[model samples]
Target: MTKNISKEIPKEKRFLIMVILLTGVFFTLLNETLLNLAIPVLVNEMDAAPSTVQWVVTGYMLIMGVFIPVSSLMIQWFTTRQLFIGSLVLFSVGSLVSGLAAALPYLFIGRFFQAMGTALLLPLMMHTLLMLYPAKKRGTVMGFIGLVIMVAPAIGPPLSGVILDFLNWRWLFFMMLPLIFLVLISSIFVLDNVTTVTRPKIDIRSILFSIFGFGGIVFGLSFAGDESVSWLNPSVYISLCVGLVCLSGFVWRQLKSVTPMLEMRTFRHPMFSLAALLLFIGMMTQFSTIILLPFLFENALGVSTVAAGLILLPGAIINGAISPFIGRIFDKFGPKILVIPGMILLVIGLQLFIKVNTATSILMFILLYTLVMIAIAMIIMPAQTNGLNQLPAKYYSHGTAIFNTLQQIAGATGIAFYVTMMSVGQNLYPSTSGIIGGAGRYSRCRDTVCF
Candidate 1:
């Protein structure tokens, strides 16, 4: 049960390996959210519409979603060193191409390559961590992974604001270039293959199903409410329908496959299933808040972009900084103690947002938002660790891939739902004057119209 295969590896070697892996993961995650604030800048500079510029972000996510299922297969086929180095190379090259891109096409292509790398790297890192650490120690290591996940996105908007204040948008990629190169170089020296590779016969049909399934669903949801694409568009519905059908086929095939691409048996464990459900719900709230808060700050309250980013900075920092301690707590006490209170706090924090208005104090917003961040820190890592712990060592790759893929889907769903809600809310007001008459009126009337 203790999968202590890493006992042969020296403690220093293990530490160094983890350091390199963490460094790579940190930057990859940072790159994921880095371009969010720069979308408007790209629109003006590249002469692209908002909808078109959004594909840069959406395309990246789409590729990640599509390719993530294959990662379980890839980890099984390749050594840890091979996948890690390959991911870094792909990410580095993509960053360079994006940084040098003179047109929107080149930028999109570069993002695609970046997504490929991220898809591989995410699962590879998690699987490697599970291999390196024993079950008892995984909570602490995963907490650090949680820190990377929380902190990178937190830094993205503010970092973008500071960069755009002086430099061109390309610096977003360029600034990361050297750090990436350093990690790539160090990884060559430090990283080792921990998992035994078994070359499973590649199922072309399953691969196609995965691509269409995840890709179609994500693409449809991502553009669901775009100005150029109506939610009621036949193409959107077609895509979702195709995605759902293919995804069903993919699951069925996995359940029946002699050597499944992604092990479906992980769900048989009650605790694992429950943990996944909690993580999915938690992600919906986390991603929705992340997308909605900037709109409220910048558009509703007339706060500057820089000020908006700064306002959220403290809470993000606090969220990440406390993750390690939360992980330790999860180790001592089981997940229920941490996750239940965390869920309650998350609900309370979200409910508090119902009262936010033009007159709401910035300090109050920060406090409530920080409380939500704390809840996320408490839930995300603990839940994920607990779920994966329920799996046998052989299923680590599949479990991590499924967990990450679901998280991506959940985030996309959250963003789409919240943005659509905001749009519908604004439309209900009927005029600019009505929207501006009173923030409280707009808030109350948006969801339920005033007679």
Candidate 2:
């Protein structure tokens, strides 16, 4: 979309700039899903129940959903340096707190703080990059940023697995401290202070509407599977119902607001909205894979924790390694070439997942999983590039915030759905062999029904 972008950059300075921006994105994206593998370990170590463990993931999503709508306001209020440094500080504090946390509630609080910080990094990095790069190269610049965001989470699970196996669950949070410090130090020198009030005012009512509306939907989706077990649960219905109602109100309020937190009008641009939708889908499947992988390893495949983690490491590394190259492709070929294939590859990867079983070979499993990661790398950056290109320059920051917010929400939805489906299936088919035996069909199912 940035048809006339430039190719000129001093190699040394280019690398430095990229490092600064990528460092920020790496942490943001890592935080998005790094805990995927750690969730199981947390449950085992903390002696927590499934319902309680779900909150570790859900709470992070809740905080992210509630606070993300206000990022535009924060950007408008604070200087770029302040925002960047502030986000790192907040996120780092959260990491430390989570690392030392002895209870689930404290960990949730830590995650909440962590989400607050992560929510800002995405928008600020984009804004910072746009400031540094000339307009001609904005797409190229953002493509790289997108690459960082995409690649980090791709590898996080395997990395988390390895860490959890060798060290402890707390390392996941502790690991981030150094990265946060590096980004903080980098921002001190590399970041520029450029805050302007010309954008829009922070309307309290609009912010509240969006936060509650989005938060409610996320809350409901988070519990949809677990709640389905009890049809008469008022809280379940209340969460879903209130979430829908509030979201509707949020839409109405945004339309009426003179200075809205989100720029809903941008959706009038078809390309922008479609790209956002693709991003939603991309995030949905990506997280679905993330949620399902551990189960495949633990329950279905019977792989040890370390071995399963090792199996995943190659794919993660490859995806992370390939992201920068994918960014460059966006510069050369545009997004359409990359996105369609990426989506197809993603579907192929997920399809491979459907075949997994306890008897499946490890190498084959790794190969299929690696293909999925490749698909993820291919689609994610291109989709981001396409979405950003859809907006005008003035709205880019808010647009990025909105896109990332949708991505986070979509991921939350995907995890919820995947978990819910698994829970439902496990319940519905409990002791399939026994059911077959009772039905006098045990002979028919001896070979095919157990798996």
Candidate 3:
């Protein structure tokens, strides 16, 4: 019989494993948003067409959607060590390929590989935490993990900006090479492999459904910023309808399956559902804000790449610093105490953002933004812990995936929803302002502006 390492996980081993897991999580979180800031750099340096180069971003998102739903199966199918090392290898290889690529398509292909590995890293780490730690300790450990995951993306842009300012955009991929080796070594020593019986059959149909449905949804939302498509257009409406139907079908199928890709029943628990809802809301604002920052910094704010990162650094730093404390507090108190305050801070941050114009100061922006980041970090752990806390130990592997999948969907949806709302606001606000410019017509259309 294999010796159970449950009671014997050394402190050094635990710390090493966490470092390994965080390394993977860091790259995963960093890769998604890092490239947003690098797009202009890539376009200029590589001389790539905009439509074609966009695949780098879109392809990564699509692969993330494709691979995410399968993460739960991977946890059960492969040993923790197997999954951890395998994913790291894939990501490392992808980064190397992208770093060395001579052409755009190859770079995108490399990004797809990177996305494949990244999609599994976070959920798998959460599963590992649950498996490795005792019940009481799991929350604390996960809180720290949550903090790492949250801060990495928040800081990714500024870090990437510094890299791009000093070196070529390829350095973004090259930098990962050394970190990848460090993480690989850590995985070999830190990760534990134990056999479990619950290797549920992979539901290929549900997997395809999730991929197509989510992909369609994201693709449609990606166009929200420009005057690209009208909602009244037949093609737009059809795609939206089909995407909604496919997602509904995926949910319906999950409810009936013996081994569902997502366990809908878990959401039946009130606290779990509420946490999931709040997570959705938080991710919506946080992710959208990250996406918007690069555009704002570059265009409206006129901040240089290195300068923007320097400006953004404090938010990420404060966010990371506050997470462990939030975790400890959540363990002592319930999630509500942290979640409520964190959300209020988030709203304050968002409200402050509305005041940002072409002449805004970086110092003033960062001050408000830091509060948003801290608030988000505060809520993330408690919310994630609260979600996982509702389920039993056996479901930990699957449950973590479900939590992350919810986060992914929420983040994606938040981006889509915010873009759409902004588009609507832009269209309506200008037209209304024009009508108001004409006093005679303005009186007739007064209800339009008020409404």
Task: Give the Cα lDDT of each candidate.
Answer: 0.84, 0.70, 0.71
Sorted by lDDT, highest first, which candidate order results? Answer: 1, 3, 2
Top TM-score: which candidate number? 1
Local accuracy of candidate 3 as per-residue lDDT tens digits, 330-398: 778878898889888877776766555445566887897787888887777788788787786656666
Over 326-352, each residue of candidate 2 has an lDDT whose tens digit, in order, gives 777777778888889988887766665
In model 1, the runs with Cα more than 4 Å from the true position are 1-3, 225-228, 434-451
Clashing residue pairs in candidate 3 (N, C-alpha, C atoms within 3 angstroms)? 158-309
State the local distance difference test value for candidate 1.
0.84
Tens digit of per-residue lDDT, candidate 1, span 264-338: 899998888988898898888777777667666766677887788888888889998998888888888878889
Better of 1 and 2 by TM-score: 1
Model 2 residue 22 lDDT?
74
Worst 10 residues of 1 by lDDT: 442-451
In model 2, what is the error at residue 398, expressed in angstroms? 1.8
Model 3's TM-score against the true structure: 0.87
Off by over 4 Å in 2: 1-17, 31-50, 134-140, 162-171, 194-199, 225-233, 351-359, 431-451
Q: How many backbone clashes does candidate 2 have?
A: 0
TM-score of 1: 0.95
391, model 1: CA deviation in Å? Answer: 0.3
